[model samples]
Target: SAVISQKPSRDICQRGTSLTIQCQVDSQVTMMFWYRQQPGQSLTLIATANQGSEATYESGFVIDKFPISRPNLTFSTLTVSNMSPEDSSIYLCSVEIGLHYGYTFGSGTRLTVV
Candidate 1:
């Protein structure tokens, strides 16, 4: 029911820097989620961007480190603040419509902090 478009497909930044990755959906969605994936590893859910409420972060992930905003139904943004080498990973945006429609994701933001 939706397609996602993410900005800054990849980036390399210095330590202590910050990056904001955006996700745009083709259709209205009730939910949006941010995820991170390391090389050769599975995706890790970062947080859920609520329509009218603060994002719910997963364990070991906090809002201060990865802040998210969902101002409307078809858009959301995730900011990775204070980058570090250990923060290098692929950040993704996902949206699920229904059981039949399944989930769709953006191309992803590959970030590397030196």
Candidate 2:
């Protein structure tokens, strides 16, 4: 099993500001993923980070808005660039537990832009 920790459980920021979130894992993992849950919405995949490679983002997400970095096997970071009120959402870090167990997510970083 892998344990993941995220910083800034909640924060409020001004428009046009950016916030960087850190994700640390207790165990080395092959893949780490980022997700967003807007108010009253379901979870959506932002990107998938793999060690030694660029992050693969999902549809409707671009690197300029949500840049990701995976420096090693146990750590990664996601930066929410150029924040806006529309960007307000719960950002979460996740990793697959096992072939049968599926993915496990961090508690989430709640961001509110105003």
The best candidate by TM-score is 1
For model 2, residues 4-71, the per-residue Cα lDDT tens digits are 89988999999999999999988888999999999999999999999999999999999999999999
For every candidate in turn, the CA RMSD to the true structure comes to 0.8, 0.8
Report backbone clashes per prediction: 0, 0
lDDT values of the candidates?
Answer: 0.94, 0.93
Runs with alpha carbons beyond 4 Å of true place in candidate 2: none
Which parts of model 1 have CA positions greater than 4 angstroms off? Answer: none
Candidate 2: residue 36 lDDT (0-100): 98
For residues 7-90, what per-residue lDDT tens digits would candidate 1 score against the true structure? 999999999999999999998888898999999899999999989999999999999999898999999999999999999999
TM-scores, all models, native as reference: 0.97, 0.96
TM-score of 2: 0.96
**Candidate 2 local accuracy as lDDT?**
0.93
